[model samples]
Target chain A: MKNATGIWALLLGLTLAEVALAYPSLAPAVFLLVLLALSVGKSALIIAFFMHLRFASRALTLALFPILIALILLLLGFLPDAQRVMHAA
Target chain B: MTRNETTWEGGGSPFAIGAKPLGMWLFVVSDALTFSTMLMVYTYSRLANPHWPAPFAFSPSIVQATVMTFVLLSSSLTMVWAVDAMKRDDRRKTVQYLSATMFLGIVFIVIHMREWVHLINDEHITLTANPWNQPLFGATFFGLTGLHMAHVTIGVVYLGIVALGTRMGKFKTDHVETSGLYWHFVDLVWMFIFPMVYLMSVKR
Candidate 1:
């Protein structure tokens, strides 16, 4: 696909942005947020374009999305408890 | 084109035999759950000891890990090329690209071995040693990264098998596409691990 090269360029740009965020002056939470955003963006691009999941049937995409959603929910749900435990320790 | 027939035929009906790409996605999802658990543990450990000093202060050898990351990521591109070649029915190009991917995968493993030796021998960050004055740092670092390296080693073996299969004309075009899916998933995991494990704790 002609668009594949452009997607890679976008990935490279995101990586560059991640490197820039490593600067100490950036707020730590903000840096983490930016990194997470870029990571999700890169994953989306790879899944949608390179994997051709974008062109696939809606049922297939729906099947995969639920698993990812559950994983995210699990991660977020445990974060507070983890933080509390860490602070207590 | 027969609209009356419910089944579209290639190697078999897509639903009957199941698409190889779909099967690979199922595997990837299972693998993702494994990595997610590891990452959750990593986060919990880090949270437990936020003030703990990192083991290595400014080791330039860590850059070797970065280089390895780049090599692994580039291999994904080769894998995509291999899949494209297969789609075009260019077996020769497919084999070449697969070989290139296998070679890069081996290079990554070799570099990883060197980095492991440096971490263990030079830095003395063994399982029993607390190099960073934190007990869990060495344990969790090695555990998470070691598990990832194990996955990479498994991927290399799989790629080698696929390379041989391609040479023998055992892999149908769809099979090559499926293998490519797994290869790209491996790359995807490393993309996350590279930043989280290697880059996250880097001192400014």
Candidate 2:
């Protein structure tokens, strides 16, 4: 099993990358993609290793993923409207 | 004597009381519903308002928030290690990992407080303040993030108690893994929140 230090290093590296990519020089769309990828990756790592989901039954693991998917669906569905509202306001 | 007074050293009834993990799962499910409702409200408000404010207009310091995210993430790592150590019967290592987990949780909460204070006192972005004169932005921002912060505070206290209890051997060996499940769930919620609340609106 991996130790906590390795996990911390991975999290730190990903976070620094996020901060660096937040600059305006980067394309906003590309930055958003990277951010989403990093967030999902970090989330998976925590859930699989820290949460012991990897060791848990398949049913339990499947149960958790749908809740996360629902959140993502909600975010994506509303984001466009949210952008329009901000522009209008 | 009451039936509850019966203590079987090693040969109790096969059907026992509620398992700790099952109890933890029930708590996690309830907590998940709370967050889901908040997120739903956030989505609904965003949909209704459309263009209430730009993300950067909020003036939250991205660097500080990102660092706090890392702290919380690292704490999750330590929490898992604590459980792993307990499974191996390494009490000292378990304590070490739990201590580290609790310390990181505290640091995250402290940084969160600093961010809130900076926003309220220096930035003057109160719950009543509206960007573009839209009241929904303030309400949604405060309501969603404030609710999440309350969870973080509760998690910190939970970790504190777990740390102290580990020292006193209050939890059986099996219970450590159960506690880890709850701690990890808390970390998972922050994973979503850090991006949605801090990073998502950065471009504006």
Candidate 3:
């Protein structure tokens, strides 16, 4: 991330957006969705640019891929709970 | 198999991804898993109990946390600048950037400690109980957030060592980049923690 300062500026904007949208006035579902989305985007930016993953070799990328997948899949696993499943009688 | 024919005998990069950085990457992934599992547990418990209270407020805690987040994010930027300086082999500039990063890191820890005091003393929250009468909430809150705070505290000290080593002409580009990787990983963890711990906990 040669443009280190610029990346910081973008991160600050996203963070402020998260704070702004997290207010009680906003609907809970929308607030959670937007904030989580923004956080994921911020993580991507940091990993690719600041962490130099973009310049990393294919082998390194492959090495890191499964860890990232596990995190995402953990969240996806919660989808059924968020869906409010019916209990078996 | 003689020493003369051994290409590895000479000083060369050990791994395809560069040995030091590859090791750092492994550490980052393992650390990520640690925090991720803690956070996922928090989420699961929070979801399991619909009545989980939103104890974090905007008055003192949230605002302070927001500032702390900014501090950490800014520190990451400074760390990157330090790496850039190292790339140019400018020891002076590298030291300056590293010092700035360390300063911001200390500032973050101070602000976080203050907030923790507020939460514990003023809010009467602890690992066991709080004003919310939801002890489980406090447990998860302190457990996860406390773990993250420990990381920031350790990072400050870690960067301090790197800064001193760099000033003494001990560290080079690879070492600086390795430290940068660690710092950025801590920031990345907070990027997720901030929203989950503070933003998501706010009442709506």
**Interface RMSD, candidates in the order listed:** 2.8, 4.9, 2.8
| Candidate 2 global TM-score | 0.77
Question: lDDT values of the candidates?
Answer: 0.70, 0.68, 0.81
Off by over 4 Å in 3: A24-30, A82-89, B1-15
Better of 1 and 3 by DockQ: 3
The digit string of per-residue lDDT tens for model 2 on B6-110 reads: 334434432232367756766776777677667556655644453545444324668778777777777777777788888788877888987887788788778
Worst lDDT 10-window in candidate 3 chain A: A80-89
Query: Candidate 2: where are CA atoms >4 Å away?
Result: A1-4, A25-34, A67-75, A83-89, B1-18, B40-60
For model 2, residues A41-84, the per-residue Cα lDDT tens digits are 98677767676667666755565567756765665665456556
lDDT of 3 by residue, B85-181 (tens): 9999999999999999889988988898898888889878888987767788888878888888888888888888888998999987898999999
Better of 1 and 3 by lDDT: 3
Better of 2 and 3 by TM-score: 3
Candidate 2: the clashing residue pairs are A85-B50, A85-B51, A86-B50, A86-B51, A86-B52
Span of ten consecutive residues with least summed lDDT in model 2 chain B: B9-18
lDDT of 3 at B130: 76
TM-score of chain A of each: 0.82, 0.75, 0.75
- For every candidate, give the share of true A-B contacts it also has: 0.17, 0.43, 0.48
Output the number of the TM-score-best candidate: 3
